[model samples]
Target: MLTIPKELPAGFEAYGRSTDFTPDNLPARLQAAHSTKAGTWGLLHVLEGKILYQLEAPFEGEQLAAAGEKIVIESEVPHRVKFVERGRFFVEFYRKAELTPG
Candidate 1:
């Protein structure tokens, strides 16, 4: 069984998130191999059912995430997801937290 990383890289903070998506409502871009922008990361949170997460090229592998679980996405890594069962999930984007001058 493939193990999914549960934690995001240190210093990164959540910047945004996608609306919850189900099998019938998932976008084609997400169903096909794609990647996060440079310096950005993503966390796929499964809210219901299960999803198949697949990585491409240098990170080639796959894993299944069920309700209440999350999969960490590395920056610039090609990856995609498919519904394994009736599922609902969303991707939360992250980036290094900018230091603010006090």
Candidate 2:
């Protein structure tokens, strides 16, 4: 039960609402995947328990995270995540309009 931002700008879209899961209640050999729309970014925050995540790109970083840790990644940046313990959390997906001028 968390309130997430729903405000989106032009060329940006939110594919779906935030998702929550409990590790203790999840079946073994389970993994969740979300596809990102082009020109978009995704954010995931751990509100409880711990988890391990790895981004299959230059943003690669792996470690165990406890409550209050957050991870942000851009679209097409393949990543994998696993729950370390039974807990609650939220994941948000957002799209960006344009790339910043280099």
Tell me the number of clashing residue pairs for each predicted model: 0, 0
lDDT of candidate 2? 0.61
- Give the alpha carbon lDDT tens digit for every residue of 70-94 in model 2: 6654565555678887676667777
For model 1, residues 1-102, the per-residue Cα lDDT tens digits are: 333466888999999999999988999998898998999999999999999999876665888989998989888878889998997999999999999999
lDDT of 1: 0.89
| Candidate 1 Cα deviation (angstroms), residue 44 | 0.6
The alpha-carbon lDDT assigned to residue 30 of candidate 2 equals 27
Give candidate 2 misplaced runs (Cα > 4 Å).
1-16, 24-35, 57-60, 97-102
Error of 2 at 27 (Å): 8.7
What residue pairs are clashing in model 2?
none
